[model samples]
Target: MASPKSAAIAALRRQLMMGDGLSPSPAPQVTRLGIAAIDAVLPWGGLPGGAIHEVTGPENDGAATGFCTTLLARLSAGTRPVLWVTAHDDLYAPGLAAFGLSPERLIVVRARRAAETFWTIEEALRCRSLAAVLGEVRGPSRTVARRLQLVARSSGVTAVLLRHDEDDAFANAITRWHVVSARRDDAAEDDSDARWRVDLVRCRGRIHGEEGYVARWFVEWRAATGDFGVVADLRDRPDRPAPARMAR
Candidate 1:
């Protein structure tokens, strides 16, 4: 059954394919949320680069805007522009400032309903300049989420969808989280060490930190990964040992 010439050609073809194009590859770069413990816990050091990260919660609990603002602040602090597409309009501007975000850096879009909000999110995710794109949306069809997943894969930025309701949204997301303000550890001197509990209800790959609950804060970060639970005042993080130099 074996012809010498045919066998030789087949072997050559296999070698060419293997040498030039048959090698498989994973995601280009998978960086974490850049939060200390969070990145440490994630498999690729972060959520898959182009993956949908679901933030689900009850009504407006500051969980939606708050998490997005802080995550973006961390990113922008590292030199990335954030695009926030929300239905809240101007009501969210001052709140964003409280999280150390410059409204100027935010590209805010007003969506009338949940569906429109998701549409805008997918479009911006396709853009290269944005560091992260956050959208306040509710349960989206599985097809839409899968499509968004593709856009996320192509763009390194995280596509964070704030699911307004938990029932369907949580069920369908690759990763779903319910964020709430955890009790403040005021036993310490300063109160700026506010912490929130990020509950990772579901994630496709390995994630670090405790799943039931994880503590994080409003403090300035010196390192890409800080002790999220250490209760250190923003003033004390070693990265910025000196008193904060606030800009006017």
Candidate 2:
């Protein structure tokens, strides 16, 4: 049973998908984050498929990459391969494997220029063969964002933009996320686990009070299971103390 707020957001998303004189497509399947509280807030009960989402972090922050890799691992659970486009050749296959995304399931494309990167992402989104497309881009224009969104919708492929730029110029993305490294006091003891403070900065079709639609969570990624566990929900109480370990 969908909550009233969830239903409303779904309706709004449908309306937006139907705009620009394009015929309505069937509702897309969602990928749950495996965290109940996080899932509950999402309009589709999870991250919506056939839509474009953005993730960002401070310069040189690997937490954002870790977060996106986890998402890709989930999205590419099936036989369909995922396409990753980036200008820099910095993606480590071993590190990605630790996050549960195998190199065999990935197709990497090296585009030296921004234009080439965007073009590759758009083309990959149009291919129904891909389960998802991730592009490491910075400061994409509004026009490029819309074009990618439309293509992803038509092809039913999820698109994720991993950005390091602070520009918030893209209004067409369905969601925007900001991720940063979270420090734990016993960090040396649990060096294998990656902790992050994830902020849902923008969500289309979701309404909130003066605080806007922002939500924050402290999450820990367990290397053994390659899964995320909630450390704490900081939305309503930012100062709330996190548990010594993530909730199982």
Candidate 3:
């Protein structure tokens, strides 16, 4: 039998999912990444919608952009537009079509300085009509990160911060991921399908002691299927024995 207090809490959670009683309907409780390997490890069974997530990659590596854009496609899979704020205008719009993000639904904001970038991101996050807001900055202070996290939580907007290769400042985001490009196992020359080696360097609510306990995966985005999935398990690859390093 369910205890009274437990049942009430469950009821409240259900109501929140339905966007009634306490939370607004515009924001869903969670946005499943749709990748089983990654989603299963997340505390919420998916990326927390109304929170901030940070992604970084090696300097000049194109993998980070690919991974983030694919993620944004999943995060903003609705009628609401996605806001992308950055100081640079190097993002190629046509490349995004392959990732399922239409250029029409993406609103780009060019900021002249880092402060302007963060300010614009903060303001965009507060808008309920936006499905997600992505900010590209070189570095941000911990204080600014905290402010962004708090605002995302309050407004129920998914926030993504993309850091350049050299910028590795600490942040208060729920999850911090490091991405790098990986070659396909088949050794194909074409770039039709892309692979990535992703590392979860920090997760806010990760279990203690197990902070070091981790596993890495080779994630792939299949253009044919339009989804992301684990292409190879780094720990145990089909072509090789148990290895400490990924088959990059």
Candidate 4:
């Protein structure tokens, strides 16, 4: 009962999905952050899947790792395992559990050199069964980054790069984030919450006039519920009160 034009369109869509035609494969869907305000500004309404994202922090600061772990927890909510590649063996499994990432759901790969680390990351990204891949590299060249981005897109897997210090811009990355620990004046001795100043330094496909799309938020990760709560959005006026906590 389908019309000729309609049926033709449907067949073309099928081919596209199956990667049978000349057109490139469809871009992976977006993954929402579960925060309305944050999602609203992004081009895809959230983090784009099948792309590379970068997170960086100051030396000896665990803020970047913590933030990346939070993202891994969200992405690996399903049964698929996540691959984490690093050159060092300093990762604490128990600490990761605080961020909702369990040892059983993670596979750690220790590479002896930076080249090996990137190789492992690319291989992991090619595996369709993995929920995501995280690589701890100081600074990857633009060529290496582009290669990873293409592989991730083709395999439909998310790739995250964790760095201890600032590096040159990665042109192929979908987003770049900077995180730093934030101090709370009023705090309890037993508080296990993690507070950070998260900055969205660069996001592709963002439209905010000529001012460039940069945003900052003071956020806290609740250890009990494994949720992220926004303390404040610095983009707003200082006098304005912070918004209510975002529901997961």
Candidate 5:
């Protein structure tokens, strides 16, 4: 059962999702992540447009990039142009293609500095012509994050913040997601599914329990359907011996 506060948030979310109880002509459409279980937990049935979302994963492992690419592929399905702002120039065009983002639909802006990258991201977010704007940033301050959120709300474009490490201090983002490469399911070696351990670290509009309602999901990407499916609920996974920390 949802708490009263949670219910109220759901109602407000519905109103926003339904165009603020007014004409629906100007309201942006919501895009489903193609995953049922994940959608069910969101305040809106799907990812709401005109909002900022954050995705983070282990540092330097490319996990964050992989997750962001998958999300971009889904968000760019209408063949809309997507602007990706990053200081790193290591993005491989071929690898992105595997995730369904073609070079023609992707515009990459390589910034020499993080500040430049964020400026480009905000500019792209304000462009109504673009479907989505993604930025690879780190240690984003609340002020900068709030600005991005504001821009996204007014432009009806989705702004995705891809962080390489754990930093969930931005309260302005609608949702924060953490993704990591999971141990491969040994039994499914022959299968084509790409497995990931996903965490819903925080949400703005939902009232969580005393423990703050963090949810874990074992998600797998099914190539045949081109969608994500929940293979297991990992909230209660058994504890194991901690691995040695890798030297920096």
Candidate 6:
């Protein structure tokens, strides 16, 4: 037996979740939108399969780079390869290398124009072997975004739309994320604390943590070599083992 209040609350929550409009009808096992607080924000705990996600903002370096890298790394966690389609060839190699990502996991393809970029993105998203598709365009239209969103949802791969400040359109996206990196500490080593504050500007039916929430990045480190890899786990992540320093 369920209490009246508790039952009513459950019903309401179910309604909200249903209103979310599930994508990738059957849902692809390989699709995951992002990690960290990002996964925590969405009602699904990850980007829905076959749905389009819009990542917008200015092209100022490091602002979107960290998130992009982290997002890709998470996508690669699955067996499928992630495709990064760019219009201007802006993907960085050193940054990626430092992330400890194997080149075999990421496919970087360059396109000359927004039109071609969108097509490439659509094709990649349609590929059953792909885990996710990253589409970067300069200035795209509402119709175009809607079309891609439809294709993404039908293809069963998460379409991560990376755009310059002017390009991203909000009309047809499953989620719109605005990412900014602030107060970066000089973490000379990997174990140091690196805080990334993410603002989930828009999520259709669920509550996003205040405007900015704390998501700590667990940077990959080579203790023996004194080097850094990509930012992978969230700080104080439940899965991370307790530091040996804290045991005694």
Number of the top-ranking candidate, with lDDT as the measure: 2
- In candidate 3, position 209 carries an lDDT of 27
Candidates 1 and 2 compared: the better one by lDDT is 2
lDDT tens per residue, model 5, 180-237: 8776555645374677877777665544433333566777766666666776534444
TM-score of 1: 0.66
Better of 2 and 4 by lDDT: 2
Residues 1-248, candidate 4, lDDT per residue (tens digit)? 89999899766654543341111447466777766666776655777678888888886889999988878877887467999997788899999988878878999999989899999999999998998999998788878887898788788899989988575767677688888988754536535377888777776543222323256677777778877777664444234332322111
What residue pairs are clashing in model 5?
none
Candidates ranked by TM-score, best first?
2, 5, 4, 3, 6, 1
CA RMSD for every model? 12.3, 5.6, 6.4, 6.9, 7.3, 8.1
Once fitted onto the true fold, the runs of candidate 5 whose alpha carbons sit more than 4 angstroms away are 1-28, 188-190, 208-213, 223-225, 233-248
Instruction: Summing lDDT over every window of 10 consecutive residues in candidate 1, give the lowest-scoring window.
Output: 239-248
Candidate 6, residues 3-73: lDDT per residue as tens digits?
A: 99989976675555334434523533433443433455455667566666667656774555556655666
Worst 10 residues of 3 by lDDT: 239-248
What's the residue-level lDDT of 65 in candidate 6? 55
TM-score of 6: 0.69
Candidate 3 vs. true structure, TM-score: 0.78
Candidate 1 lDDT over residue span 137-220, tens digit each: 767777777777667666656777776676654333445667765455455653443465565555544232432322233333
TM-score list, all predictions:
0.66, 0.84, 0.78, 0.80, 0.80, 0.69
* Candidate lDDT values, in order: 0.59, 0.78, 0.73, 0.75, 0.72, 0.60
Query: Candidate 4 regions off by >4 Å?
Result: 1-24, 187-192, 207-213, 233-248
Cα lDDT of candidate 6 equals 0.60
Candidate 2's TM-score reads 0.84
